[model samples]
Target chain A: MASPQTKRQKSSKDVPYELIYWPGLPGRGEHIRLALEEAGAEYSDTAFSGDSAVQTVLGYISDTNLGDALNPPVLAPPILKHGELIINQTPNILLYLGQRLGLVGDKADEDAVFKVNELTLSALDGLSNEPHDCHHPIATGSYYEDQMDEAKKKSSDYIKNRLPKFLGYFERVLKGEASKSEWLYGSQLTYADLVLFQCVDGVKHAFPKAVARMGKSGDYENVFKLYRAVQERPNIKAYLASERRQKYGMGIYRHYPELDEE
Target chain B: MASPQTKRQKSSKDVPYELIYWPGLPGRGEHIRLALEEAGAEYSDTAFSGDSAVQTVLGYISDTNLGDALNPPVLAPPILKHGELIINQTPNILLYLGQRLGLVGDKADEDAVFKVNELTLSALDGLSNEPHDCHHPIATGSYYEDQMDEAKKKSSDYIKNRLPKFLGYFERVLKGEASKSEWLYGSQLTYADLVLFQCVDGVKHAFPKAVARMGKSGDYENVFKLYRAVQERPNIKAYLASERRQKYGMGIYRHYPELDEE
Candidate 1:
């Protein structure tokens, strides 16, 4: 095994990681995109557009390079570069990037990093599952309209049960923070804060009613403040305003008021 | 703010943490159990039984100290303690515990640790989604019989695409190790190895035909061997034998021959 002295990312060559994701919905890719953008690193993004996405996803999943072997997810996008690395789970991907980016903060800061990351991932998981539910609602195989009744039920379960659980968890993290500053992490912006922004964006896109009704609760105010602050970061602001920050559609967040209970 | 001293395990006059999950079906609880067990720490599994589980699950989703005031999920075995912390999403839980157990190995080993753990999390995510598909086949809300065709499609996609993608990635990781060592982290064991054992075990129980067909891909030989070794470890062996290692049922894995496209 090589010694640690030489392995650290002390030079430019260390920034060779490539991020792959659908050119459409910003979705989970934002977490990764944000980390890379904020870090000002030289990672490449192999973004796919429209009809080409499916092949791109499949090709990456099936690649046999020891560096790129196995699949990350046969889904929208998976990120890779060097160190023989690939990851599909967005929060998992972000956690990997957070370590390299300053997004994770420091060792003394990791507990919040871990906790906020966990909550962010849980929210994203809920959102992703619901996204599929948006299309299929009943069976992943059948059309969403075909299973409208079942879709309504599943979507109801999601809007009523899942969203609050996630938002409430974020609220608690804020409440429990050593400082009362708004962000989920201590006071400053962390990667978790950005994901929370995405989560809010997704929820607002998918379940606006549920989110608005529940917005009366005190927990969301600070989370919203953090969300707005994250939105204002120069790099983050640019990404969100760019075409790369595409609106949610057939992806992880789809708008259908019928799916969102009052 | 408290000054940096040591990130000591949560030991207090009050209970350190409370882990709530169904008494049966290891689901996502196994990883939490592993963390607690490895730490040799004190904890109370809040709802490992029939009634408490339902109450705990409902309570967590609805309440503030538990849910973050967002919509809750129908199936979330959440953990609470140490400053009223509540988190779900299995990879997040395991990531939190890796450091706690000293199982994460080394800081110099961060890249490897992140890669392997991400792979492990990706594997578990695939298992969870596919396991859900085994019964649903097509979608989430409909009865098992309602969407068998869709279930088949989803499962087929999983077996052909996801299974190869995940397993192949790990196979490459083991192959890519500089010393030509078998472990994903080269010589050492990681939380990823343990989760891989769970994935293999779950696949065998839930989709025997698919795994059987995949039939011992060469790279995972070390993983399989490690699984056996983990089983041999006195604590793990005892845990498996104990009531704590809940068998697959309706939650994480369900053996449905129909979904297992042999």
Candidate 2:
């Protein structure tokens, strides 16, 4: 059996990870990028591949495409390619990376890793997924302009109800005994913290006024603290300041003045 | 390391799994229950405990609850308590059970387990989560009656566009080389098949007209074939016939005639 150190070394050295996602905005791909960047893992993304990047992603998800004997067909991008294997789904990608990058925990402590994953899924659901639905409440294929009124109503309810519920849950999680440190899981930092960091950052971008009010009101002190802690991490800090980190635009989190808190 | 058979034996016999979820409707709890029943694992649920069951679930999820030193507080129900550990999130619970119940794959086949999880997450997102959103597009806290118009719009969009996209993806997956058998992964059945079965069944209950139309159109032959295979599994067949299986009502999948495909 490979030692954790040996496993980490092999994963980082042997495979040159390829991240396949749309180029412009971060979208769901940013979560994968954050984990890669935080670990300082050797990787490449289609962010700079120009027109071919879009085609490459589309090719994998094309209706007629039946994945080869090993890999399965992809539904959407943010796919990770390591050696001959290819996989997608944001949380799934994280779960795969969490072990390889030494971001989860010791292999012996399986519970900790699963706990981290559970926290990540919850964070993604309430913060990332629900926030995305606010603008596209009627249909993903429809334009935000067409669903403007619905977006307004949904965003309002999100700020009033869902936002507090999720943020409060995380705040409580951070205060739990297992979280002796600022990280969501154990004393050691895990991929879940990176996910929550991105989630909080995205929601702040989407609903600045509402998030700011909650922050000022001291409702989520621990949650904001963890966000700030992740932001200040050396690799993540450098990544955020680099040209590689894509800005939020028409992706999951969008800031329309009408959708912001009143 | 223990053999797969030994590990399965230990998990099933040593830890009497206690499933904690609201009684009556299947809801998200059904997904977890289906997995347990399929494995024929020794488990108990709050279904027969009546009023106390509600209190027990609420106690774990109460806002003031700072879970004991080992476990973190639960965000919501459908929690599983095995030994000293208490975990929530439907997929997380399944991931945990998948390992112990030997439903994912062989321990050495790590990729298969992760792949099963990826398929489960995708199935849950498109089939399970989106269908629920069709009725409560604006806010989960709001009543279906209040959001009836938006519900109609979201449900229509779900039926027309999203449903086909997801079902088609699964059909293509079933045809992929990796899925030599009826299952989503390798030749063996994994927890993903169980999840997909539940998702398809829930959607059928939610939108009978649309699902029936697609069934007759023969769009998802492989997908439905696998669903039928899962339903025919002896344990599942028996569980369905027993009173242990809750009826679907005002849960994740609801039958609102107006929300049906015209």
DockQ of each: 0.25, 0.62
Best by DockQ: 2
Taking the tens digit of each residue's C-alpha lDDT, what string does model 2 give over B88-200? Answer: 99989999999889998656655776788888999999999999999999989989999999999999999999999999999999999978788888888889999999999
Winning candidate number (TM-score): 2
Off by over 4 Å in 2: A1-13, A106-108, B1-13
TM-score of 2: 0.95
TM-score for all models, in order of appearance: 0.75, 0.95
Interface RMSD of predicted model 1: 6.7
Model 2, residue B16: what's the lDDT?
82
Query: What's the TM-score of chain B for every model shown?
Result: 0.81, 0.94
What is candidate 2's lDDT per residue for A154-253, written digit by digit as tens? 9999999999999999999989887878888778889999999999999999999999999998989999999999999999999999999999999999
Error of 2 at A109 (Å): 2.2
lDDT of 1 by residue, A1-262 (tens): 6565445434423547777776666656667777777677777665645677656666765545453232222322555544444555677677767766777645564355655566566666665655565556433445667767656756776666666666666666666534336766555567877777777877777888777777766656766666778788888788767766567766667777788886
